[model samples]
Target: MIRGVLEMGAAGFLPKTASPEIMMGALRIVLSGGVYVPAQAIASGSEMVLDRLTERQRAVLRLALKGMPNKLIGRELGLSEGTVKSHLSAAFRTMDVRNRTEALYAIAKSGARI
Candidate 1:
């Protein structure tokens, strides 16, 4: 896992043995635009695949990640509802995910910056 983290150029690697303070620090780093890798890969057993998105797709996903509704996202991005849906579908396809929950898991597990 450490090897993968280093190879992926992630921001941090934390072992389960780390203290609560250290874990919190890792979360803070991740929240502040950094990556955090655990002692092992995610139990979901998937490789980090955050690099697979286009810029637009990444933007949409970021809004989605913030728990925005499709309508709100459309309004904020100056897009139509249908276009938002289209972008969402394309983003899901690009991430190979079936739904928002799965996409969120992938994003968190991958430590995706977008």
Candidate 2:
């Protein structure tokens, strides 16, 4: 896991703990051919082996990435907004993340690429 972190650092994979603002800032630097690591993340570990998400979680996440709100996602999935929130919470836990942005980042960084 540590090795994966090191390699990710070398290859530029930001951890899921990064705030959306920080992530966007880091992304700008990366896009300019520079690698940016958050100072607080220096001691953070790698995201190794994310178990495959359930079909429901994946469905919710797919819409979430498309910028859908939980209410809309629930409506589309024929689930309650509360149920969508629960699935999102479980997805965040399974992805080792805190927010939707971080989960999306982790998914991308982990090579799932949405």
Q: Which one wins on lDDT?
A: 1
- The lDDT for every candidate, in the order shown, is 0.67, 0.65
User: Model 2, range 1-114, lDDT digits (tens) per residue?
Assistant: 423553444535567877899788767655654445444333234543344678898799767655577888999999999999999888888878877556545654545433
Residue pairs in candidate 1 whose N, alpha carbon or C atoms collide under 3 angstroms: none
Best by TM-score: 1
Can you write out model 1's per-residue Cα lDDT over 7-112, one digit (the tens) per residue?
4655556787889987996777566554554424433334455566777777876776555667888999999888888988988988898765466556656754
Please give the clash total of every predicted structure, in order: 0, 0
Position 14, candidate 2: lDDT: 63
